[model samples]
Target: MQTLSRWENTPTFFPQFRAALLEHVGSSATVVVIGASDGRLVLPLAAAGHRVIAIERDPVALQGGLVQLPDGTEAHAAGLVERLQQEQLDDRVDIVESDFLDADLPLAARYDAVWTSCSWHYSANHHRPLADFVTRMQDLVRIDGLFGAEFMMPVTARHYLSEHYTSPERLGPYFTDGWNIQLTLRTGQFTELPHIGQPHPHVHRMGALLATRTSSVTTERA
Candidate 1:
């Protein structure tokens, strides 16, 4: 896997990924990130002036990363809160230490965008049906708001958890009815380093989606 700096240097993913979303959700918008591990996906958005609420289930996992500082020294960046503090970005970020499925988020379309990278596909582990999980994510965003996600698929379908692996073809079916699909990119035959300490690397199939909510759903006004 590329280092954080390398990811940012590319025009393909990472830095560009956030920039692409920024076209729809402005830099100052309020964004909700599900499975926001450490500060990788949400930190740059916060730095760019967005109000970010980062949700993660395992607080311990969030604490295990190295953070490079502006002063030329690197530190053992602890949890999300600590990362925000170390970078002096706590004011724009709200750290939510809870299972996203268990948390009671706002009902009235509170966020401008809802995003997840390689996280939403794990809904199956929690026994939340994929369709239902997609619906719940849609419900989190207001009309015209955006919903974005990147899912990692196993090379052999049966090798991993059933709900964890999703095909590029399977994604659109879940959101087409309720969303104005903005972008769908599916690519494969690449090796991905395991994020959760799998000793050996594995071949991967990756798919990403960016969609805008077009359907109406009732929610109490905040």
Candidate 2:
């Protein structure tokens, strides 16, 4: 983990990741981004001309990111909706403030793609009972819909503290049956977080997974 300031100084890694994500976003695609700290993913999704529903539990971080955006960006902050709403967006792009674990999946509506990055590691209880979180994520996508995620792997401890390390082998059980393992790679980089003065060290092996649902399901089923 680099200092916050050093990390901020460099161009974000999302741009490249976003390029990969766009391939899965069709013309009528709807998207949901969870744990969207500081709207890093939201800003790009909005800029890419896609409608996105960005969910973040931290109000302070959300507000901090929102304040920096130019006016007229199509984004909203709320909890998941009980029913999907009709809106001008290709699919509704919403920003919800709530815990991803407890969020009402039925309210958020189904999406063409559900993408999360670097945030899943923070799931409660080390993402215990993996089935629950996996099901929640899979539910967000329509049948044959794309699921894209960037998860931290076992080697993360080399760059930062021992607490940040996670192994993909431990994370694999959460995926529903028939999910495709599209990409898995071990890569390392020095992240500079200058906000804390000294650059904190971090090493991470990222696993990028792509999967699709076996059946078409409604929000409630999701």
Candidate 3:
């Protein structure tokens, strides 16, 4: 795992990923950001005019990032209640800080779309149990809501031995779903990181998927 300091400073690689999400979400939507480390995506979501509920388990990081945001950011520090308070969002976005497994699905809140990027790999129980996590992720979205995620492909021992590193796939089962996969396209040569004092070989293969929930599940209780 990359150090928090390093991960915090590193630039976002998949810029198009964010754009795709914004386009899918539309305007004046409510968004929930789970595993929001340092509010990287939250800022953009809010800036796009979405009432964002940013969820993070690490209080230090959450507080630190929230403090940096300008007023009217509408962030929920450690719970889902703040998400439930936004009245303008109609089946739009709702951020929750609870573990996905522990989240109460029967609550009054729901989202028109749900998005998780490069963060689902850290699911407490689903890290190794990829299939289970995918099912849980599917449950979070309202029928036809969008689900987007990026994960590392599994690596082989021989390949790891040669490469001296592991890819996202090797970490676990976050990539086994039946959704259509889009290969990430990158241009330009690799650049080294001066801070790390090494050639930062930009090596990673990412898969982006969008699925429309076909089930009849409604956002509100009957």
What's the lDDT for residue 187 in model 2? Answer: 49
Over 169-209, each residue of candidate 1 has an lDDT whose tens digit, in order, gives 66766665546777777775677553333335567677777
- lDDT by residue (66-161, candidate 3, tens digit) is 322223233323222232223222234444556655665553455655555556533343444444445566556564455555543324344333
TM of each candidate vs. truth: 0.79, 0.64, 0.55
Model 3 lowest lDDT segment of ten: 76-85
- As a whole number from 0 to 100, the lDDT of residue 38 in candidate 2 is 54
Q: Please, what's the RMSD in Å of model 3?
A: 9.8
Model 1 deviation from the true structure expressed as Cα RMSD, one decimal place: 6.2
What would the per-residue lDDT of candidate 2 be over residues 116-135, giving only the tens digit for each residue?
77665563536454345556
The 10-residue segment of model 2 with minimum total lDDT is: 79-88
Model 3, stretches more than 4 Å misplaced?
1-14, 65-95, 105-109, 123-128, 155-203, 217-222
Candidate whose TM-score is highest: 1
Local distance difference test, each candidate: 0.67, 0.54, 0.46
